[model samples]
Target: MNQLPQEYYQRLEEIQAIDFVLVELTLYLDTHPDDYQAIQQFNQYAQYSQQLKQAFETKFGPLQQYGNSFSDAKWSWGTTPWPWQI
Candidate 1:
């Protein structure tokens, strides 16, 4: 597989980091459902992650085979290179 561009990797890293935070917050919330602060933090992270994902997809293509990421004129599923190929 070929290496993806630096920006792509950077965005992926950011997404991963944000996802980690979300997961951790989710676990905490599960145990302490009344923690409004944690819930707010989780929502913020979720929104940020969504924005990052949309940006990534807009530039680099869909991360998965499904979802609303395919908003382009042409079907990009088979055209764009996969993350592993990059």
Candidate 2:
């Protein structure tokens, strides 16, 4: 398998960062539900992460899950591409 492109790896990193923030905020918010800043940060990170996911999927393939037809019109799940340099 080939390694992922620089752009793909960079976006993945960003997605991971946002996910981390979202998880942390959710944990904190469970105890401090009244924390507006944390809530806002969570929302912001979530949206950013989704946007990145959509962009990556649009160009590459499904980031997760199956049956998505954004990249290929055929059976995308079985044909899921590997993230590596060819």
Top-lDDT candidate index = 1
Q: How far is candidate 2 from the true structure (C-alpha RMSD, Å)?
A: 3.4
> Which ranges of candidate 1 are over 4 A from the true structure?
78-86
Which pairs clash (backbone N, Cα, C closer than 3 Å) in model 1?
A: 2-86, 3-86, 4-86
TM-score against native, each model? 0.83, 0.76
Candidate 2 C-alpha lDDT tens digits along 48-74: 888988987776677776443354666
Candidate topping TM-score:
1
Give lDDT: candidate 1, residue 65: 69
* Clashing residue pairs for model 2: 2-84, 2-85
Measured with C-alpha atoms, the lDDT of residue 40 in candidate 1 is 93
Query: What's the lDDT for residue 38 in model 2?
Result: 86
